[model samples]
Target chain A: MGIHLPSLLPQMQELGQALYERSLQVSAMIPKAIKALHSTAELDHSNLQSKIKKAGNRWTGAIPTEETLNLTYPPPTVPQSLHVIGADGSQIYPDRHAAAFYYLINIGSIVVSHGSGKAPTIQQESQLFFELEDLYDEADHPVQNAYVNLRRDVAEMKTLTKIAESLAGEQTLAILDNSLLLWMALQTGGSTSRETDRTLQQYLKLLDRLRSSKTGLAGFIDRPRSVSVLALIHLAGLPDDQINQETLRLTPFRGLTDRAIFTKLLAPGHRSALFISASPLNRDFRTAGHEVHFFYLNTDADGAVVRVEIPIWVAQDPELLNRVHAGILKDCQTTGGFPYTLVRAHELAVIPPQERAALEDMLQRTLLGHGLRPTQSQKALTKQLTGQRKQHTL
Target chain B: MPESPMMIGRVTRCSTRGFVGAMQISENALPVFGSLCQAEAQGGRSYVVGLVYDISITDDQFARQLAALEEVPQEQIADGQINRHVPVEFSALAVGFHNDGGFHQALPPQPPLTLASVFSMVSKDSVDFTSQLHFLQTILNAPQLPVDELLTTALRLSAQARPEEERERFLLQAGREVAHLLPQDLTRLENILRGLRA
Candidate 1:
């Protein structure tokens, strides 16, 4: 039986009250800190860079700032002729209790041609994995959904690269609605998934293809809660040695988000200064000439800050950067402050839970057709029997 | 050449009574309020012909706001309408059918199946279906439907379907059928006659 939520009303209210109080306190705390920074926090790029070099062995994720303490650009007007493509992926994880250990990934993508007045090309492709190679890593352990999802992301980029190649002109941008740092999930310090390394190589290869074709690639993370900006705040708050992880926990900006701080610093339609993320995952990109750098843009009111990440190629080139900015801003206008292509792509890609259930039914029917009896594990059967469903059956 | 957008919808629901069924349509320019729709039964062997009587625009708070929306620029209107799916459940009359290349004015053997392709049979095809006014009984009884509108359009199409010599005769027969069906609503009947005469 589930614990009764009504029974814990008093405790829930107490917790809610505490959180609400803390939020108010944080709200007050953040604006004051940002105001102080506006007056005193130098862009301090050189000092921050030297300190970063000094603390290389100790710290991992402080991003290097551009010239200004921050940079915010007004909303860029979209060019007359352009092509915007976006891809999103969703997956049904392999159920251990199913007939076979299998997973499925569905990628949905759209290509919107601006100034052509044509309906966007929307497509969804679903791939099923049941082979041994798909089920296991190089080290032979059964792969989890996380690894499969990363592979799906790689597949999406590969699809984008192919699409970009075919389009060839009119200034294109291919977007993924997630972080560019695919290696973040694979970096567990001691163990590196060789499969991930292979995927990374392929991902970077696609980045090169995209770059050669002049197709801008970006990862758009909306309403991001990242504290990448906190590193700068930490640098400003304490000395190099004092700015270690343990000391960072004690800083006043502990629970504050970069979004929260930037909300005050930036007006709507403005982006912050670029910062090269120093995460271990970003290091590989740096070596491969595609380092991941991010800048926060406030797309709408009520402090909506979306973090946009680009490879070093786009970041280093001003025209490409403007295209990325203008392209995204116009697309946002189409969707009321979100990427319209990404919205359509996600709608095409997301596999509903009912579809997964239907797939299982099909799998059972296929097995029965082959005269090979396949049954769910007893534990799975038991869970199904005991589960409460919003449906009727015998 | 493609003669007008080939309108296609899916059968959302159907009824055993053969009087009414609902088809869900999403088109930028929806089927005219009173039009003919046809559904192919399972295979290509049989078909169910229907009259489009009611168009229900699906609603929620969002759709309400959209409906209340005022003069938007022409370009924005084109893109904005993409989000306004507005699935129309046009209540239809199971008027007649064609089986094995033979046409019959009668109820469908069965209601259209769900998710079956529902095509808006237009132009001469619509004119051919309403050649007989037998479907008017169901149309008249459906109070929710616009009885006057359907009678007028159906008679007009049936008249157009005839040869020039028989056009007057077709309207006379359809008028008699309407007068017989609604003796009490004579004003409405007269209005329908005015529409058919036009």
Candidate 2:
């Protein structure tokens, strides 16, 4: 009714063709890139290593790996009586259209008792941030998106830590549906946000507690684009000058990502060699005794390979690593690509738009009950009017 | 003076003809298929008494995911079932009301408010509610409800809730009352009595 579908059919065909052709081009480059990464990983590029060491916080993006190209395709082996814990977070960002700028975070957790024929136990915790201090930083600046996200990350880890503390017996694996490396915090050159650092401290402490509970923690990133291995690709060029952000940006491997390479590299159940994340955020993690390492796992051949990141404890233990691999593959079989626990956790945690609207209505009513008129933004009022008119025309 | 009936749920959707509520019922202490339940209304000045008719058990997502765990030991699902807050929903048709010192066989002046706590009617309340034949008229006059179903259920519950000696008398009076109310519909009267007899 609105866009006239018949008129756009030809253009849609062209768009699809362009996307298909581009994917083919990306696929063509993977073999050479993989070969370059393998050779560079074998070479002793002391100059690039020195450059990375001095690159400091100013350097953005992933650093390359120096591991053998050969990867292991292990047979899936999950423990019979393992407890798989999955947690995910969903948040309503601070909205300007609403009467008082506020945010809401809901974290959901599911603990599946594998080998125990029962429904998995699930829990959800919700918190509203409308307090004065919560809405703004100490300097009275409104909290930015980055800060809010960091808080959510902290909240998620805190939930996992609590679940670990309360749950006992049976080996536990805590799976996070996100990257463990705090890449956002690392981008703030030299000095990181104070709130981020303190939160990271708490997060690491929780990780320690989870590890102590004998729960191996892993972060699952489906269709990962991180080529910390690309740093090695860049290092192979034999740059004469110390590598800075400028030199790293101009490196040969610009248009490529790791998913294209690993999609061809691994088969179902095969995992790539573990490589430490060159994300600067991992430096603090390394200092605190929990170095983050990642491997590309082809959970299903139909989809892209997933990058599974783990702390030192999980990467070092062959038994834990195998369990993680098998656990992910087994879970993926149910959901087609992602783990079932994560899917359930996300479902439980997500707050739909209807819910957010209802909450805002309630908030507005409560504010009005106290004799305060909650004013709507002019832009929001106009949008509402336009939307109603648009609906009528349709 | 009587044991308090467990508060099962709060009124979610409400009206004079009937009301639905969301209940937190467990696997063990679930209510019967048809039981007498009451809800407080108008600051306890009166109460709405109704017959529990429809019960819908949610937690589909919970069950579907659990069913997927074929690898999980059967015993865990059997005995290891932790306390679950399963949402049990039931809609009840308002049969009568109790005010001051009297029970009427008609709708209350006001519908029970939303979020009102619905309680399992204690045996004493049930015995008292079915003491008279007037409640039968309330069900027949209320055409929107499952009249035959409610009449049979109320009769059976009253018989059980009453003293052992008066149980036969209660059902006999209900049979006579149904025969009188639906004299034109003999088939319907027979069905109701046959249901009660069973």
Candidate 3:
């Protein structure tokens, strides 16, 4: 019988021999590598824990001392009137396909004095602007309204700056919603595609003027990237001695405990402002050096004003910071245990009025036992609507 | 009934035992069964039906058989029709079978009865031997498969045999077949094998 076979036998034999050799070599090597890896892992675990403990201790004692402070000059004279501005923006999405509208509210309040003592009647000014653009639109065309709004903000900022300059004696702090605008202006160096860049440049020039005049400029930006930019700018300007002690620093704290304790611990005459929302436990607030008050500003059932104290903290205080940390850890042990009040307040503050009402309703229902009443404005509005209905029927 | 006499070989010297052992060694080092017939008169025409028995033999057995047969002088032996029982062991090499009723054959027997025919026979038994060999060659020649993939496959196959002895033997055989095809790192191969075990 004729038997046929493929002619590739030699090659196959060669391959088989090679594979056999390699397998043996590999079989011999594995045990050793695994052993080494295990040993290294064990060592690393112990070392890591010790290092962490050491670092925590160092951070605890790291607060700057008064002796380390290098003041180029004494603190400037306190202005007669201190203007604090706060701006918030809310985006509204009606449907999946519809463009969203951004409603911006800029609230500027003139605080007469720097200390806890009341001095003069506060003059409050608020401006509302709307930008209608689809969020899902092409990146290039995404809401040209921001640029228009930016131009308006620049004009307002100039006016505010001029007002600050013209005032006989006042410390003006013009708070912008974001630091990106200022950072971009500083980096643009005159080359930009949009005409708004010119106004932004002017704003930057105004900021420089404020710096020269010793008018403190601070911005509360939500994004970490903006913070990084600010840190970089501060690093470039300040000397090494001032880096952590006076100029640039970062404090990370969670929950209301640290905030409250820190604020209480602040020297009685020292003034500190806190940024807080509804959920105090879940979110992280990053501040440096100075103390901040963490509180909730919500409307009552009638939409009247209501303020709830959550937490307050000065970042430099070790005792208060430790307490805040411990409180957060303790909170983690509970179920559905979030600092909900702060979170809700933040949500209400960020959301537009139409949506805020629904959120407020949900919050009130959930927190009914907490004794939070609706604001007087909400009650009055409801009454007015009902009264108008009765009058129309008659 | 008439009685019919047919020459029957009892395999007085079987190469199976020794040859199989040698083959096992070779395979481990590198990568790489008997029958009788009975005749009886059934019809008036004295028709003879012979039962053929084929013993499955490995490469080593085939080698032993050849070694045993070498003692007989071919010239002195009667020139009768010699019917050898064909072994059915598949060869690791061979191409596709043709429709002409003839399957792929083994390579020529090497000197001292390397039994190239036996190898060919074994190779032809595998239906996909040809295709598989072609794939292996392509892999080796062109490096078609990723090195990681090849290592993983090798390790998995190596891990399949449970006892250390069996695993070693299996890997040895497989390694011989694909030694040149493997990458240089032994650790990588071990890792793949461990992964398979896991």
Candidate 4:
């Protein structure tokens, strides 16, 4: 029998009811917490500042002044080329006796480049096939197949990376479908399934290769497994002051902004972390023997956004972080703003359907002025976009 | 009406020889038995005749054997003799045809007969009869010869039979026999059989 969405309607209804009730409870409690905070403001500030200053004193003895190395070159007029690759796999069992097969779709597109304020070249293409029979025995269960499929996905990623490397230029940005690296040093020599261990080792190896390559790798992983692994890695390398100050703070009331609270409490250069999505971490996260520093970026109606601290030791140098930040900022300006952020200019560059092609043409013209010749594929894409634009107008 | 015992013997031998001759025409033909049931006794004796022929030789040899069986002795038998037993068997010593006079006297006439000749005729006729019998046997054993093959084979065999009454009787019997079989299985078999026929 097919999976009917209607069958899940009752559960969804129940969840909706629960969420409604929970929201009401949070609403009632927030005002009480706000009132309490206002009454305790004076007493809390004096005590908290003293406690924070005492904690900060241990690390305040010496400030190291490292000369800022400038890698920023003269502004090159090359057209900004942004490439985003997102892959998704769906497993389907067509019949009872037939094996469950996975269909993996890797979608890659050239987004806007650094110098050109142009609309990104977006391409959506896919590949489909049956899962290889040799990868698993018929007797193997679904969970085992999940691990196998993950490894298959990783292998696909490696191939994609190679392609990205070949296509990548000095100004190119490669966005992975998932996390670029997984720390699994603690998983080494542990009593885990051989398949699981092998998958972790493969992930680690891929990360190593990506780091060594000239192409920059960024992944958009929505799953909790990837997030927690990132969080753990971030926490391990946290500067001491952040940890000491954060340890004493009360867990904020549920509806309050946890990230805001952490930010207020944190000393300059200190870190605070928040977990979003509430998904269980992937199995590899349990044993990824690495010290990670986690910093909570913000908490708002959109939920918490956090950053995983990549240790200078593993990241090889602190300059890489500076480069990453510079790259992100440059991408923001070139693409009209950061693609991942809610920055106003970035949103404007994402032209609505009706104006997409016209906007693309305008951007292309601008890019041409910067001496970037569009490839043949890009020309075909532009033609298609223009056609779509005409159709939308009609 | 009962024929003379000599005539009955002659007829039985002729029928048996005919059966064996037909079998000898095909090397792969299997030896088979034929049974004819009658309501009343013939010549005051109930008889069941069985015949077989071994045709290990080539077609030429088989034809020579059939020629010998046609020359069986009839003169020695008494007229209108009833309930008499006449058992005749022979092997080829020499074989020659009677020659007409062309300035020379005709060769002495002799009864030409061989046991192989009688056996060959009986076996050949028996195979032809038994071919139909085997079809019936398969229907009885398998009870699932495709309805189409069964009906088509029945129709073909009926068309070939000399007696119309007998053909009608067999056809009626086959219809009643197949009614007990599974319809779908029979239908599928029928389709397969139709393909085979085409």
Best by TM-score: 1
Score candidate 4 by lDDT: 0.34
Q: Residue A143 of model 2: what lDDT?
A: 73
- Compose the digit string of candidate 3's lDDT tens values, residues A1-394: 1233466688789999988987666445444333332342344333423432333322221111121111111112333334333232333322222121333333233322223233222232334333333222233333344444554456445544554465524443433344323333333222233444455556656655543443333333221211221122223333334445323344221111222222222232122222322122112221211222221111212211111222222223433333232222121111122221122212323544655566446545645556655343555566646655532353
Name the 10 consecutive residues with the lowest summed lDDT in model 1 chain B. B71-80
The native-contact fraction of candidate 4 is 0.00
DockQ each candidate and list the results: 0.24, 0.19, 0.00, 0.00
Off by over 4 Å in 4: A1-17, A24-112, A117-145, A152-156, A167-169, A177-192, A221-319, A322-394, B1-198
iRMS of each prediction in angstroms? 4.7, 5.6, 57.0, 56.1
Query: Candidate 3 residues B78-117, lDDT tens each?
Result: 1111112222232121112222333222221211123311
lDDT of 1 by residue, A185-238 (tens): 574222336767877898889888998998888999998878766765665656
C-alpha TM-scores of all predictions: 0.88, 0.78, 0.23, 0.33
Ranking under TM-score, best-scoring first?
Answer: 1, 2, 4, 3
Q: For residues A68-113, write the lDDT of model 2, one tens digit per residue.
A: 5445566467777777788888888887886878898899888877
* Clash statistics: count for each candidate: 2, 8, 69, 33
How much is the lDDT of residue A190 in candidate 3? 28
